[model samples]
Target: MSELSSPGGEMRLDKWLWAARFFKTRQLAIEAINGGKVQVDGQRAKPSRSIRPGSRLEIHKGSLSWTIEVLAINKQRRPATEAAGLYVEDEASREKRQEIARERRELGGQPQEGRPSKRDRRMIQRFTGRNEPSD
Candidate 1:
């Protein structure tokens, strides 16, 4: 069997998360775990927590969430396609994420592109009844 599927191998939760492509870096994964944005087996976990195959993970990042079961572990980060083989996402969680994404798309509130233009600022001020005195 390949190293990934080798039995009895375990890894740090944060390291695994980074290797699995869930976060861009191990530090980000650590921060998420510390901030309670990540849970293992329905309980909050530390960055150093050991995780092996079949461990359940719940991760929340802003409006997105994922519930996944670990399938394998790797010691180093890999390409996205390979990382995806590390876990299996629950079908309900997949559907919920898709629904949330669809709803956001339908809502269609485009984010403001940078600092608002002078005219746009004036309009906002006027709407908020906080117009500044003319310079």
Candidate 2:
């Protein structure tokens, strides 16, 4: 067992994001906040924003953004599912992400596996809607 957490409730938004695995570390969380990758309740917020159990967060990373409702104020990092419990994802964003991933997978660099002949190896320039060959 580890040291007990403070019962005084809530933690900083930056700290909670790190603990929830939304970012790899607290520094990353801060960077995201400062870089405009985070929003709260439809408005931009600072790293020092005090987040409570039900506060909603809109987090952007890469080509994705997640809308989550905070469920707890955990300062410790945990496993994926356990960390996921810290928030509930917005359904619209989840579906959007899924569609994006699927599109990327289908239109990305991977060629379908039936069989490629020697000629395919020679002129496989237009495989994934692009002229680049898959490595």
Candidate 3:
């Protein structure tokens, strides 16, 4: 319960995202919003958008994505534990992330062992049916 939320029980999307520990800074949250990485109720959201409790957000960060329901709004950034209390990740989202992680692990830790040689690259391209015509 950080001193957040406007009189209407809503807070700026960027500020809420920051206070919730999603992005490291308000600037990053703003950038993400503008970059279409964040959506509210399945629609693209702006940093200035106001969000309230029970609002659903879909956030995509790199290879990880989250669908969360806002449980509370905090204006001030807090410790991880407290920040976590502000929202609950959707069950399906949680399970999907876990499955993806498990698959990555089973795929042998690092997918790329090292840079492949020219011949190796060609072989890989051919195997994948991406053979290109050589000049």
Candidate 4:
């Protein structure tokens, strides 16, 4: 049964994020919270902030941002699919993420070509061995 919709359940922001799979570790979630990468109900929140069911969350990571509503709270981390069920991503958020991904793909994946730097050259020389005589 889903724990979402329970009237009195509450969870810590960092714990929920870790259990929901938004972060690989609680420390990362805390860092993100402290860095202003996450907000609750349109306001910045601390890692220890309490989040109940239906709370709105805004999360920014790199070029992607997500607006999601809390659906459930699970203290123990679960499989990806189960974790996915813990929140509902807004339609606009999903569309925006998709559009960004499409643009990134269309822009081409290759980086600009440039000559190797001195450090790179030294590493290559070390790898290839400067002492090796050419045939």
State in Å the error of residue 91, model 3. 0.7
lDDT of 3 by residue, 53-103 (tens): 889999998888999999887777889988888999989999999998898
lDDT of each candidate versus the true structure: 0.91, 0.82, 0.88, 0.89
TM-score of each: 0.81, 0.73, 0.74, 0.78
* Sequence-dependent TM-score of model 1: 0.81
Model 1 spans > 4 angstroms off: 1-7, 111-119, 122-133
lDDT of 3 at 59: 94
Q: Which ten residues in a row have the lowest lDDT in candidate 2?
A: 1-10
Which candidate has the highest lDDT of all? 1
TM-score of 3: 0.74
Steric clash pairs (candidate 3)? 4-75
Model 2: per-residue Cα lDDT over 6-113, one tens digit each: 334778888889888999989999999999899988889999999887788999999988998887766788777777777889899999999989998989786769
lDDT for position 97 in model 2 = 90
Runs off by more than 4 Å, candidate 3: 1-8, 108-135
Task: Write model 4 residue lDDT over 2-114, tens digit each, in one string.
Answer: 54324358999999999899999999999999999999999999999999989999999999999999988786887888888888999999999999999999998867479
Q: Local error of candidate 1 at 89, Å?
A: 0.6
Q: After superposition, how far is residue 40 of candidate 4 from its true place, in Å?
A: 0.3
